[model samples]
Target: MIANFSQYGIKKLFLPITSVVLLVFGSCKDKAQEKPTEAMVEEVGTADGFESIFDGSTLNNWDGDPTYWRVENGSLIGEITPETLLDANTFIIWQGGEPSDFELKLEFRISENGNSGINYRSELLDTIPFALRGYQADIDGKHRYTGQNYEERKRTTLAYRGEKAEISTQENASEPESLRNNVQRNAWQSRKVLESLGHMDSLKTKINNDWNEAHLVVKGNTMQHFINGILMSEVIDNDSVNRNASGKLGMQVHVGPPMKVEYRNISLKQ
Candidate 1:
């Protein structure tokens, strides 16, 4: 009887100790789950499906004005000099075949007065050398025109910085006098600002003459542009006649004062 009583007492003591241990570990687990610091990781360029396009030493698959475009310091550099100033913009095109639905990413730096851009889903003008007409992810040193969508030699400004626009076809679409760059072109397309991404001046504060990451997410009829990991502008085009789903890609150096633009780490995912 004494042995059985002692056994019962030992079990009673162990039951409370087991309960306390379980409660301690359970409380620690709950506290650990409350702070998910590991899950809040920021990701950049770590996504799948990306492939490097620029070889860093050669312009083998790119075509443009030899005098203006060159490989310098492991970057694709396009510069304009007093002797090479132009009456129109010029482009250094990518010959890597056009992308239909894809994401493009790269880093760029521009001179204080430089004006340049990334042109995609574009068609090279047969009548003009180094001229492409299509969608442009606009970039400029002034930051006033940076991060906008400008259709080169075409429908002009489709979406300004801090804007999200939906473009559709219309029977009669006219360019309002309030619109700038109504450059000798007309399109049966209408653009509606769906929402504001942010304030333009506030967004430009994130950009500078330093190296900035430029990302383009062009899928289906939607095209989004991001600078320094911030969304700058977006356009959803339903204008079938005016939109190009797939075409060539290129970089531009606009006509104006002598300026320089450098690009590196050009990558694409399709």
Candidate 2:
């Protein structure tokens, strides 16, 4: 009788353990099936409410004379034509007709020795005037001064490249105990020098060459600029550099006859 009872106990334990193993395997399979579906959904719904401003074939949303801008290979190419400068007495302007607070994203590729920029909150001028009056995001094919903020019309640099070692050393020498407690934290990766106020802040990683992405967000009394996924500048509206609540957007085709800049995938969201 004792041997039979012991055998029964062993059999009951084995059955429950085997069932638990099967249940776990089934759960893992279900999770594996779910992952791909989630990814597909994300891929399709990525561009929420943003609308494409450039059609890749023509300049539809923008209003400007044909002599200043053209469409080629799916890019809005703005050039400084001899005729345009001579006749217009200034740069050509592309008016989108409507303006509001919004975010703008565009990809740009610069020809060698190329210097160009995206102009936001700008106005057409009888004279070319200064490039820094409105809000211009700096572009240089060499990446030497790319992503620097040129407060257009204002003629001041809001930010520039930073030095990492100097910032780290200063912090460490001043507060040894703080460094010990925060040793695991990363050193300043990217530097942004605010020339107007003489302030510097760390930025996201710098982007160079190739096609660099610029994201500008303007909302109410504040503005922010991001490059290649790093916040490069933040400023409040004051008399020295206050942009109109709304203004025209323009692209610069700097003064070299051979220089060419291509812009595409421009979209805006409000």
C-alpha lDDT score of every prediction, in listed order: 0.87, 0.58
The all-Cα superposition gives candidate 1 an RMSD in Å to the true structure of: 7.9
Clash list (residue pairs), candidate 1: none
Best by TM-score: 1
In candidate 2, what are the lDDT values of residues 1-107, reduced to their tens digit?
24454766866455677776886799798888877576788767765667777779976656554665688998877666445442221233444553558888988
TM-score, prediction 1 = 0.78
Model 2 pairs whose backbones collide? 132-151, 132-152, 132-153, 133-152, 133-153, 133-154, 134-152, 134-153
Which stretches of model 2 miss by more than 4 angstroms? 1-47, 64-68, 80-94, 126-133, 161-205, 240-242
Show where candidate 1 strays beyond 4 Å: 1-47, 172-189
Superposed on all Cα atoms, the candidates' RMSDs to the truth, in angstroms, are 7.9, 13.3
